[model samples]
Target: MSTNARLQANPRIDAIEQVCSKELLAQTAPHDTAPPGLSETRSDGPLSSADDVEQYGLSWETRAALEHSHCRLSLESQSGHSAHRTSMDRETSDTDGNTYPEGGLEAWLVVFGSWAGLFAALGLVNTIGTFQTYLETHQLKEYGYRSTGWIFGMYAFLTFFCGVQIGPIFDAKGPRFLVFAGSVLVVVQMITLGFCTQYWHFMLVIGVTGGLGASLIFTPAISAIGHFFNEKRGVATGIAATGGSVGGIIFPLILEKLFPLIGFSWATRVVGLICLILVLLACLLVKSRLPKKPASKENVLPDFRIFREPKFALTTAGIFFIEWGLFVPISYISSYALAHGVSSQFSYQILAVLNAGSFFGRWIPGYVADSLGHYNTLIATVALCLVCNACLWLPAGDSVPVLVVYCIIFGFASGSNISLAPVCISQLCKVENYGRYYATSYTIVSFGTLTGIPIAGEILSQCNGEYWGVVTFATCC
Candidate 1:
């Protein structure tokens, strides 16, 4: 049999030849009119008989030509699909070649987890003002203002300082155990805090223990968010960091009401219970997306070598100055109010008011930072902090109206300080090494936290309890 005869004899080859011939004709017809023989083949739709195939000049070579067209079209279609897929992948990846879901159920869930953890840890950090005021007049009344300041100073000190070690461990391992251990220490601190009356007791429970716990929880909480977001990081971190402001708002009100109803010990225990619940939620939902690194000696320890970079060193120094005065207001605002004859009931509420403004501050600047640039927004906010103190808080003296306005404006501006600092640090490093960079910067900043409050207190003492001198000190920082 001839080639056409053999092809026609085989049912499968006959079908393929017909399909390919029709497809080839349809493709060519779009751009140009079909040729005479091919036109007859197109009109018939298929070469049904061997005579039709011969008449149309549809030989084996023509059949091979049709098959080639089909293969070429398929390859082009696949190439288009492959290009589209690659474009999508590139859109999802960051500059460091890290892929993120950007925003998904899992990613948002992690944000929520970090938020809850921060609520407990940072909440206490924010409430240092209330804690300091209460301790000054009550348990530690005999101690000078500068002396009592050290307790809270130590609390803030260890909280960020330990991140030097905790950050690297988080980069190596994960958040699970670190969060759990931190949660335990924080819960223990809150539970035992009310029972402690001595100077050393407060230092041990609130200062040392609470700071360590907060460090472990704080570093991991912020770092885990880096794994799931890059583009929306500012807003997401702001949302999480607001947990602290939220805690600052609620905890003081809770203590104010509960201190009268329940007494200090049980009121604190109640706070502990709340923290326990929040940290538990964090433990369940917060997780790391990166592959685990082998916990070698180098991986587990903090390497200070990163500071060799000039930009990082400068950022760290800027943060140091920011943190130096940052805690002065947080540690002294309530006490300042009480000393100036503001009702004790309203004094505690003052911290809440500041924190309430901070609640909005934490996230709003973050959203703007996404568009304006992190460093720009941060610099503006820091400048605003200086303005609020110099223009409002410093000159207000006993004016409640001016102080309230200062609290709100300063609170809003300072809110970004906490939320954006980590983001600014993240800009200097990769997503995976975020913990180390953040911890290192804050570790240096921790010294400022350690000294800022005490320095303010000493200034207060030097000026014979006049707050202008202390306020001026904060304004300078």
Candidate 2:
């Protein structure tokens, strides 16, 4: 049958056309004329008016679905470019038949929740340098750089790697229980950190507990934002991500000041108390917009078959390389500063400076990405990271001025590495399945996070504690 005949034969399509006849006509009204039979709708005949639409006895949800589909198809056909629809076209209703509020009180509340949760989880991730420096000088002083690196590496590893299961769980069950559980683990990790004096104690609390809690919080927080946005997804995610940078900035400074005044134990407890408040807000506010699907074998399992898509595979690889070296600076900048004869005070403060720059980097690039394109913006930032590492960091030696500049430039460039990766992943799959795809990609990228720090630490040891090799390593990554 012809296309028109087939459409007419489908009862659902025929009903949709009839119910949405007026709306369809109004949408296409800008044309010089309507379709052949639409002008005769004033008369008593089929597809005549809203009265005929009501005669089909369709539910409001069904009518709404058909109306959107028919109108969208009609417009695309009129433009004669349906095959080449732009990203802007996809913005309207990109996933299944669901509609987004885009912005409303409830939607923005979700963003706030994500921001608060990330502030607590990623704040700690970003402050790893401060933690490393302190532990190296005191708790783990007897351990070699290579041995100490594994503790932090394990923390970073579980942070992203655990997303393999968390992502699918978020897709099936939503964020409520996940966020609650993650919050409890994180609070416990921070509270217990003060009491850690042994290598195994640090490993169990900071590495295992911290990593698992962070994974649960951030994965769902980022995934939930995708449910409420498409066209604006980049910026919304960026805004939420800034919470981590903010936490990075404040937490480090707080620890630095409190370390001597209050000692390590109470300082960590204070930070834990702050985390308690932030995570409580997240638990109360962060929510999933998508309806929960049934927990089933097919839905809950991780699907590696998505690698069959060449674009997705390439994206994953790019993220892997980026992540491989991304944490090196966050893990070592303080140590690098102290080794170069910078004041101990300034060494700790430099991390705050980097995170300060990151605060702007997260949201600004996100806003620009919405217009210039997510991939375009990500490429530009990654290239900037390369320049900062090679030209500024590698050559700075003991120059504080140059090192400060490197910190700012590199921090800004790397900030998008976190915010944009999820948005990019969402582009490859429907928003509903975003958690699965995002989790799977990060699951692969997790190995990079696991290895990057230890590899840098080994390079540090191999070069007799020199940082040039590590800087060069980051530049190449």
Candidate 3:
């Protein structure tokens, strides 16, 4: 029907009272232009007058929304109506999940929770190279690079893979239990990691425990933010994602300092303690704005069937390739530096520098995505990643400055792979089913994470320890 009729009948406007500040709404339409039809008795009548809107006991948010939708409906009628109507209809349909508070004290609290959880979750994913490098030298010294790769590869694998189930759970149950369980598991992973000495120990304790915890924490963390914001989602998601970069920088620097003094056991324990605090914040503050859907036979299981949609399928493929290229650097930069005769201190510090650039990468691209198309921003950043790998990293062997340049540039470009991917995925699906679509895409992409690191290591081995093979594989992909 007409946008005006749909706007009034829409149940979503009822939620406006919960989200909009009445004072803010009162300011949006200061002057009254009351039409004859609206009255104190009318609830969902056509807003005949702006003055009548205030008199109907409608919320300021609802009144303002009616006014705005009415104006847009008028403009579309004046212009070409069909195409605009179709687009507007699809966007505003309740099933598509467009209405969100977008801003409020409660919403920002969810953002804070997401940020803190990502710090503990993705921050460590970003720091895998540091972990890989250290374990190669110390704990897993007997293992080849290819073998050691499996431990961390599996860790990254489970991080995203588990989202297949977790995403659906988040949709049905909200984020409370998932965030809590994830927090406890990750803390245990870090604390127990300090005591690991064997290959199997690292595999079971870290590879399994850490990976699952990361998935549990991040899937809900990212999904919850979607419930509260829409127009600013790109920037907001980017802001939350910077928590990973923040964690990446801090964890490395802390480990760099503490590992030397306190040793691995105590050093890891320290990191665990810090994650405990952050994850606790996530547990307490992170919440879903949407009411939970009761479990259903149809909705309980994740529908992998969504990939039948071409747009979603293509988007998933795009992310799979971009992410395939992305993690190679994150998981191996420190090792690449050390192999080139970079000092031990600089090698450890380099991952921190990559993460430093990533901090800006996460925020800036997200801000830009709100203005530019989210997919447009993601595509550009992906291209940037390809160029950096080929031009800078492929040539720089033992050239500290070039390696530094590569780290900074690549780190920045790759940052959006995590932050913007969700925004891109959300655009293609109904908002209510966002977590499912997001998890499904990343569930496919997660296989790339599972396989990408080991393939790089194998490539490294086949090239007789040359860095170019792995770099070339990542660039070409």
Model 3: colliding residue pairs = 34-49, 35-48, 35-49
Residue lDDT tens for model 2, 1-477: 443564455565555455465564545444554444444554556563344445544344654565567565765555466544543344457547766667667879999999999999999999999999999999899998888889999999999999999999999999999999999999999999998999999999999999999999999999999888878899999999999999999999999999999899999999999999999999999888777888998878888999999999999999999999999999999999999999999999999999988888899999999999999999999999999999999988899999999999998999998889899999999887899999999999999999999999999999999999999999899
lDDT of 3: 0.84
lDDT of 3 by residue, 283-383 (tens): 99989867788888566588988989999999999988887777898888999999999999989999999999999999999999999999999999999
The residue-level lDDT of candidate 1 at 458 comes to 90
The lowest-lDDT stretch of 10 consecutive residues in candidate 3 is: 15-24
Q: What is the TM-score of each candidate against the true structure?
A: 0.84, 0.82, 0.81
Ranking by TM-score: 1, 2, 3
CA-lDDT, candidates in order: 0.87, 0.88, 0.84
- Please state the error at residue 375 of candidate 1 in Å: 0.5
- For all predictions, the C-alpha RMSD in Å is 7.9, 9.7, 11.0
Best of the candidates, lDDT: 2
lDDT string for model 1 (277-373, tens) is 9999999988999888999988889889999999999999999999899899888999888888899999999999999999999999999999999
Where model 2 places Cα greater than 4 Å from the true spot, the runs are 1-91
Q: Output the number of the TM-score-best candidate.
A: 1
